[model samples]
Target: MNARRCDDLRLTGSGGANRVMEAELKRLVMRSAFDVRVPNPKREGDETLLYPFDARVAWVAACYHRTSSRISWDLCSSAAVRLEPLFEDLVPVLSSDDRLPGGPELRFSVEVGAASDFEASPLQLRGVVKNAIVEALASRGVTADIDSEAPDVVFIVRRAGTPEARRTVVGIDLGGSSRHRRGARVATGLAPLRETLAAQLIMLSRWDARTEPLVDPMTGSATIPIEAAGLAVGAAIRHPSELPWRRLAAFEGLPGETPDLFPGTAAKIVALDADGECIKAMVGNLRAAGLTGAAFDQSIVIGQQDVRRLTPERIEALLPEVRDMRPGVFCINPPYGVRIGGERGEHELLDLYDDMGRALARFSGWRAACFVANPKFVYAFGHHPTMTKPASNANLRGHFLTFQF
Candidate 1:
């Protein structure tokens, strides 16, 4: 048996919210049997390094925006000598032979990050790496197809070690598509939260799927509510191993198997939106996600109501079905006035927030964890949160502030 070595792996999150992503990574590691170590932040500029120690960590890979595993920092004089042996080494270790029947007619793309002194065009180097891998596979009697542009596999080659003493590092992407694309989000609102960020916010809110209830008063496109429902109902979402990589002949682990993270617990969730168009979009998205039928109907109640007019009575009126779910979270990703289009100026936005604060005051016991772009407006809501954390979505900057009633 080849012993699993702890290679340098990189798991990506949002640009400004590494801490939130780091927290999620830790949570994922906690559920595993492996003794994984999540290192503290060591970053240059905006790039943060989150190293999770494990060889077979496909389950947690989905929670990350991108991942690069099996980092090799070995100096090599030639591309063929470097890449061929790398592919050959990975074939057995990843258990490629045990992949799906007929095996994966593989597609691949190669990217090289080397200095100019060590010359090789991206295309020329891609061809070299491609031919080397193909030849290696042929030697093992494994037939595969390689596509450069639209590939099932991606191999990244970078200069590692140090500038003074650098080595060629090769890493394989576990899958092609980012896990954030849950295949459920077909429609979106003007300002939609990234699926992973929504998941992160849900985690940060500390809602228990088995016991606590969840309500998204401004549930644009139903991303948060649908994700919560998927958690509640134990929906089968795909992971990295189930991707095209699973069809590799030497891939060993069982494909299509995900962690039983859902504990067969269903939460009472209610999603509300002021715009009729937004509610319509939410309904269509929920249906596409297979969140239908009587139970789901009772669990998730979507309707139209302006958030500005939200009151304790109005909240109950919207979801009269939430009989036992008292004092649940009102998790929302509201208009940060950055991405979501609104004609309202700064003064108007402040007033809108002020009104929202007053409306939320009516739900005396219910707490809130909201993503606010402008902290200045956070005070518009009469009460201040007990804790605050920085957050970001792509280019937009924000903070997640949790208020306890």
Candidate 2:
């Protein structure tokens, strides 16, 4: 394929959660005082976003964005299926820019897109791409090794465009690991929500982490609560220095190795779970995320409580600081009943939803946001949602519903 230069960086976020990512990106840009432009997706339903290539902007995005899964330098795009032409343009850039690893030995891997239609299988396509990259690097006097199990760097090769006019895009992964693996979740419960998805729910709810309180009534694994706590404190999702971008030549001379986090405020966050085991997991996750001790206790309160019994009075009792405060937010991810054994389990889950609805009604002047895969939740709750946003939890299609209590 003949290589075409791309002057933008690419960020891929979770499907059905692009809106949240866009909003978060804009906020980050504003806080960082960067003049980068945030543009809409090229096409509807496309999860990839493009931004003008600025080393600082890319670094900030790689470090602070809670919604992006992968950040990459848009190396080249081409209509040719062959790897030679693509790397012809890519190799010169890597070699001159010092993008290749400088060590005595280098390890790398190639990831191909599932939807990429090629004459070869996915495995074969990966092999071809790897060979092309290695040959290109070797020609530039850089020795590299193929290490799929563990690699210092990874390259993403994907096919885009229609079948009639297919195109191939190549990028170097700026972060070696997926951003969603925030390095805090040491333990998880059944149907644990993804950390990025949890952040999206919080953003979508418009929960003011500073003035308003946030509660997760069914805090399985405490993903929602942990994310809320981080947001309240203006914590970077992950440290900037941990990313691989710093080691690359393309990002050389960029300042702010230590990202400037948003100014945080004292927040009253509560996490509750009926299952003792889940509560234990939550504590472990909290500790892993460095949210412990008396100071943390003042801001975040955790306990075991059934959702049905979760009244505003119960919350006030847990932390008296919010007794006279303004209306807060209720962010929950309740059971979806897919894993529950059978008809009896489904009925029990529905009943639980009914009880949850009744308990939520007691919290006057509050807002509740829930993501559930089951449509029965609305009927059981007996309330029309103020907003119904289409979202997905893993492979299951779900809706994020908001209720005014």
Candidate 3:
């Protein structure tokens, strides 16, 4: 068993590789029996993935079910904002699928003033919160009539402070898509997600023989990539009961359905970025997850390369070893809003996507998948999608579109 100190938690930011490392720390320690809480940063890349060092604390996570940032000033995302960082503490609890990553401004907070599970609240304030979430999401193109059960993503929130401060905690219902419905609210550190993703990757390897690598080009302090890489390394799946990150009372909230959204057998999954630093960050995260000595050995390889101009010769150079392997899958989660460059990079990305589409078209046997929120990509790819699913990452309501040749 590992012992982590609560106050000793650390957070650092580096471009590229350093970000991946941040993700690694988030995966392991959070999933394990502990979490570390550090000073939270306003920006993601500036924050640290926390892990626990003590056994007395628990972490909680929360987010708005809505996708849009502007919510008529009624729905406050302050809860998710404070909650996202707490996951590193012991016994951190979170929404199964994170919400803030898709570009919706989010926040998290602790549940202060111990109260009974079924505490009463004014009906009016409840309605306001619900309307704000639903309205914001609608702005992002999600139909209010859309199915809410077991969505690919969820937002968890908790309120911490004196009762006079008027704070409340909650999470997106896995059962239905309603802003008014209440459920358990908790915080989670990046650690648990890292482990969960690692476990998923390991299990996926059995059949597909493809290691789906998570790529971060503009790796912020390195939460997403690091956590993703940890999941790639076969980390064991664990719940918050085993670890403690913060404290919160149980909630009498609704539940929703959760299931796998990614499609494919997992052979030849590749994650690439133009920034070598981001590539290194994820690699470090993978290593920290104990992947270097485990089944992921030789199964996952990350490299520093630009997504633009992916010429066949250039592609062959990086993946020369896989020449004999069957045609694989290529998936990219590029910086849609956060790292999105101006027209110069945007044009480059569009042309690169065109090249990607052309490559997939030529390979006919290969499938390329991307998380796209841009119009130009949809126009340039020039092929019908084999499957198009709605999903969220970084608070953005995006499509998980793939082309199967």
Candidate 4:
């Protein structure tokens, strides 16, 4: 027999920072299918459903225009074209000529780099980038006739690092050396990340109802951690506030659902930053945004606290505080290699990952959700975990690979 041949897709190199993750996922899928207990069975003729190859998977690319973080979104967008030939086979389940079901389009979402014009964002950038994606699809012969809602599969690309093949993405999405009347910034502003992170908590709450006390150990700008805890719980960002409630109710260019406008039982969230300036500004932003529950404080625990050093006794002490007296996993966003922090900070981060892995092995039943730019860290995470499908983050080029234990 031909060894029951199965298909596999491989994306070699960093392709910015995220290419390695994409390749690993391809490996993960192939392994899953080949090692599966039951082979994927073809539909029997009379089973009643016809699969179409007409609708294509849209491979989307996004690079954020600017942010507090360092990612050259523009360079990522420019480099994404290289992925055309490489990513063509991302999904191999359907035939080349298979017709799409009701739709023949597959689209990808890419954020514009901050270096690009932000002024126009209030006007035309969205359309322009959409056009770029359509053309990118054309390069693959997947969508010469692309349109809105036409794609069956959407691929989003964000470049973050120097891939082995595409060395060092030189472009960035931050502002130019000089400021302009119409600044080049990603206009949806910080509101979206805030809403989405909060919504993530909502979804999680639905999944595991018993899990109450939400926590984000390292609350930078206090946005993510606060949102995860719920606007009602107790919110805190790095900056200070003068007019908290008004800022929360203020009109953001992009509107989002704020669950805790009067989040009654606000989380006792503590926003911590090593920089006093950041802490001050965060307090101001929180007040300006009218956030009610945020508290600013300096924290050595956020990124600096080593997981290896956390003893079972220490963890047990806080166990009651985490899930309202129940044991819960610690969710975190570890540093990827870049900026002053991230992986570029010598090998301090790599050692951190190793330590975390060993700690996780000790806490086998603790369900943890860790987002890493490099997915292989999961292997280093000490214990085997169920991995989720990955997504791309603009600030960092690599895909956001999630591991759940």
Highest TM-score among the candidates is held by which one? 2
Candidate lDDT (C-alpha), each = 0.60, 0.76, 0.35, 0.33
Predicted model with the maximum lDDT:
2
> What's the distance in Å from true for residue 22, model 4?
24
lDDT of 1 at 28: 56
Instruction: Please give the RMSD to the true structure for each candidate, in Å.
Output: 6.4, 2.7, 18.2, 16.2
Off by over 4 Å in 1: 1-9, 16-56, 60-106, 111-150, 157-169, 233-236, 239-242, 247-251, 319-324, 339-344
What candidate 4 gets wrong by more than 4 Å, as runs, is: 1-210, 231-306, 311-324, 340-346, 360-364, 401-405
Candidate 1, residue 162: how far the Cα is off, in Å: 11
**What are the TM-scores, per candidate, against the unseen true structure?**
0.72, 0.91, 0.41, 0.38
How much is the lDDT of residue 400 in candidate 2? 83
Q: How accurate is candidate 4 locally (lDDT)?
A: 0.33
lDDT of prediction 3: 0.35
Could you give the candidate ranking by TM-score, starting with the highest?
A: 2, 1, 3, 4
Tens-digit lDDT track for model 3 on 1-405?
111211212222221112333433343334333245423222222222332212211121211111111101011222222222322211122112122123333232121211232133333334333344444444554433222342333333333223444333333322122211122112222222222222222222222334322223233223333334323332222223321111122221212221212323233334455565555555654555443454543344455555554544554555556655455545444445336568787777777667666655655365555556665667777788876555444344555566666
Weakest ten-residue segment in model 1 by summed lDDT: 66-75
Clashing pairs in 1: 95-250, 95-251, 95-252, 96-249, 96-250, 96-251, 97-249, 97-250, 97-251
- Pick out the ten consecutive residues of candidate 3 with the lowest summed lDDT: 65-74
1-405 per-residue lDDT for model 4 (tens digits): 101112111111112323222222232223221232212222212111111111000000011111112211111223223333213222221222122112234543333332232234411443444454455444445453333343222222232223342211112111111111111111222222323322232233322323433334333354544344432332222111111111111112311221222234423333334345545544554544444342522111232234566544554444434433444445555555455354456466666677876665554444555555665566555555454434334344333333444
Question: Cα deviation in Å at residue 268, candidate 1?
Answer: 1.2
**Backbone clashes (count) for model 3:** 87
Off by over 4 Å in 2: 33-44, 81-105, 161-166, 255-260
